[model samples]
Target: MKRRFFCSTLFFITPLLILACNGPSDPGSNFSSGSVTPPLFAHSVKSLLTLSVIEPADPKRATALGQYLVWLVQIDRNGEPFPVNAISIDGGMPAHGHGLPTQPRVTAQVSEGRYRVEGLKFTMPGRWILNFTVSSKLGNDRFSLEIDVGH
Candidate 1:
């Protein structure tokens, strides 16, 4: 009886003991890497803007909007400031949607590597389709991006 009990107890606890002994370890949990990798340019839509998507800074903390989002639309391959006349969300008309700007064209700043669009805000927690029309030296190029912002 004693031998049988001991064997049963050992069999049941063996896996538990092994799991406790081989517990997972957190390697460099407190370390921080300040720099981030740039987004990969998938391709250009027509001749207007180059489209690219980047992974979130931290996948675990990514929201529906995305981790870090930015749009880079450039005109004149020679790399000069292009005038962005109007921008809108979804496919709404400029006057109705009236996105980014309508008048004195806004030029995106090019620095380090990519062109930057500041304060691109997603209002709600859902999928958002952003459409932009940029008129520059080249012409008018329309670009769109679909982003999901989750709560």
Candidate 2:
């Protein structure tokens, strides 16, 4: 009886562990550029301005366990440049329940509605969520984006 119980428990537990490791957000596989279901590459929370990455075209390909720069363009609902006075960055792996490995920030404004993000590094291959807050004439708005990384 003890052996049968152990066998049944193991049989159920093994498949569950396998399924958990092979989930959509599995760190081993390379998923990027809004490829995840329901399109998580955009924002978890909406903002007055829409932020989109303009550089490193593919985040999964850019992942190398080092720092990198990511450029972003913020446009309004009408496709006009959002007047941004200040911007901040914060994000992390929600599954892991921690913040970004580094403190990334908006270093400069490349042009109207275009900003340069610096000091972004993904130490491990997994799903990461990035949050950006913009202070504009309208008000302070915060948004989020999910990116896949692999090294």
Candidate maximizing TM-score: 2
lDDT of 1 by residue, 1-151 (tens): 9999999999999999887766665354454666332333322256545533332344223333322344453433434334444543243223345342222122454542234544455444544445655555556666665544455
Clash count of each predicted structure: 5, 0
lDDT of 1: 0.45
**Which pairs of residues clash in candidate 1, taking residues 3 or more apart in a chain or in different chains?**
64-148, 64-149, 64-150, 65-148, 65-149
Model 2, span 30-139: residue lDDT tens:
84656533322354144445766666555444454555656554545456666678888898988889888888887778888777777888876778878887777777
**How many clashing pairs in candidate 1?**
5
Alpha-carbon RMSD, each predicted model: 9.2, 11.0
**Each candidate's TM vs. the true structure?**
0.42, 0.64
